[model samples]
Target: MPDTLRLVTFNIAHGRGLSLYQKFSSPERIRKNLRAIGELMVKVDADIVAMQEVDEDSHWNWNINLLKEIQAVAGYEYAELGVNNRRTGKRPLAYGNAILSRHRLEHWHTQSFGEATLGEKGFLYAEIDYKGQVVPLLNAHLDFRSRKRRVEQVESIMDYIIENAHRGPDERPLAPIICGDFNSRSKPQADAVNHLFQHILKHREYHLYPRDKRTFPAHLPSKTIDFVFLPEPYRMTRCEVLPGFLSDHKPVLLEFEL
Candidate 1:
């Protein structure tokens, strides 16, 4: 049987929902939000889930590892967390991206972008064995403030992908898929979103899925910032924006077959 995988990319906003400040101050609110987020994850039921803005041992979030919490309820056997932002204060803070899967995740690696005033942002790279084939995956979260910063980050990502594409067959990534909260709204006026899209197409030969879906502001989404890109030989059978307020950004669910 051909392998079909259900993938989801979500920015859980540290599981704080809309009450960001309050959720950090009040433990009860954090607990409530986490419970709701776990329920949402189970409902999604993705085979491999990539998350951005996830918390890892942060004091504000009651020092709870948000990815582990979600993995418990989502029934994923393997999970990897990369802390991209770190603070060395009395009450330390760390934020990053994560990947959770039912299959073993190997070759775990992470890349951080150039320094930005807001904070450090990066992507998680790993490989998984699916139906005896090695599949490469990248989960990324780009800068949300400036388009120039996002363009730089995207260029870094593209360089990495292009470099790996030329490696020998024994070392190259097989049928790679990149997905995440790009934070660059889709527009036609030569913006960061289009720049990143064209860069991937030109070098990596990857195509975006569900061209019309909007995936931000989970309550009333109007921006198409999140995306999933895959190369040929991998067919996206279904792609849709899942409706929920589990986080500030709506979760994007993609089903692909190989």
Candidate 2:
């Protein structure tokens, strides 16, 4: 059954538009949340866009390149940027996590993950084709005040994508789609699941938040921690949590059936 794609995951908190603050130091609230993140990606037409806290200032010279101005206000003609903080003083402090595509990006990769409690956490891999089939996208950002450091950075990003699994492209049949901003969607019962943290329990595999609800207060999102995952045989028709207001998480959409 392969043919259905509509994905989105956001953490535009560093477009600094209207100031979600990540040290842009405020220029009239980064000119109103960088124009409310280009009207929140054109009201979420997202066919693929997993972003999180982006910035690129080698040293605060500021030329305003908030990920090409939110992909030219959500026009997304295919993009990729996964720097995960690269500061070099006089003008080279880059931020990270961004993977966009209206389908056509054929290869990409980036690493840098950790039990990292709060700084550089990245993973933005891509290899899309969309209109003609072929997929595998991941853009993540986890580590919000430790849960065993988000279980060793989600088990070192699923053991580095299951031990490289052929480095993607060439035959592309993985069809994975793991989105972002998962500050651990609530699981503090302690119990005995930390068997060094394996992850495969959120409804036994993957299919998150809709009944699990909540996506971090855009005004009142109790707490869902933003996510979207699908692998093996692809199949998820609706996964929502998008009311939106600029940040503090509120963007997740998936359709996938590919």
Candidate 3:
């Protein structure tokens, strides 16, 4: 029998729940929002979850570890945070992408696109052992404003994968499973998501999920800016854009067997 897994990628807007910004919300409000997000995570029941714009020990969010709060409620045994933005002073702020999993995560690493103290973007890479099979996974958040920068960030991601995710061909059988807030459309040959998808196809065939699902502005979505990319061997069993106003962006859930 093959093992099956569920995964979700969501940009949580730092747990503000449709608020304009974190600064406008109080610490208690942020915590309340996060608890609701945790409840959603439980309802989804994903084996591995990718999250963007997660905060930690930031004055704006009342020095709360957002991931921990979610994990506390959802009860995930393993979690890792890739802090892409870090600044310390009278008013400290730190946040980035993160992953929570039911399986053990190993050899995890984080890479940022730039050195900006805030609004920086990046990805987290890790190799997970599932039922004795080694699967490489990445959780990323790319630039949302500039198309050129998003493409550049994709290039960096590809380069990193080529350099780090290799062992002997016989030992490494599966390509990495990537999920994130790409901030670009899946159409148009020139788009960042397609660019990365096309580039990886040079080596092995891959599939992009929720191709027609619009995930942004959860209450009234009109664009698809989040996705999950998996190699051909992993057969997708189910895919759905979850409904809710958990954040500005909706969560995409994908179920697969390997």
| C-alpha local distance difference test of each model | 0.78, 0.66, 0.89
TM-score of each: 0.90, 0.31, 0.96
Q: Which stretches of candidate 3 lie over 4 Å from their true place?
A: 166-169
Error of 3 at 1 (Å): 3.5
lDDT of 1 by residue, 99-201 (tens): 9888888667888785442368998888887766677888889888888888888888877877664233586545468889888876754556678778767
By descending TM-score, how would the candidates be arranged? 3, 1, 2
| Candidate of highest lDDT | 3
Backbone atom clashes (below 3 Å) for every candidate:
0, 12, 0
Q: How accurate locally is residue 219 in candidate 2, as Cα lDDT from 0 to 100?
A: 72
- Please rank every candidate by lDDT, starting with the best: 3, 1, 2
Off by over 4 Å in 1: 22-25, 115-118, 165-175
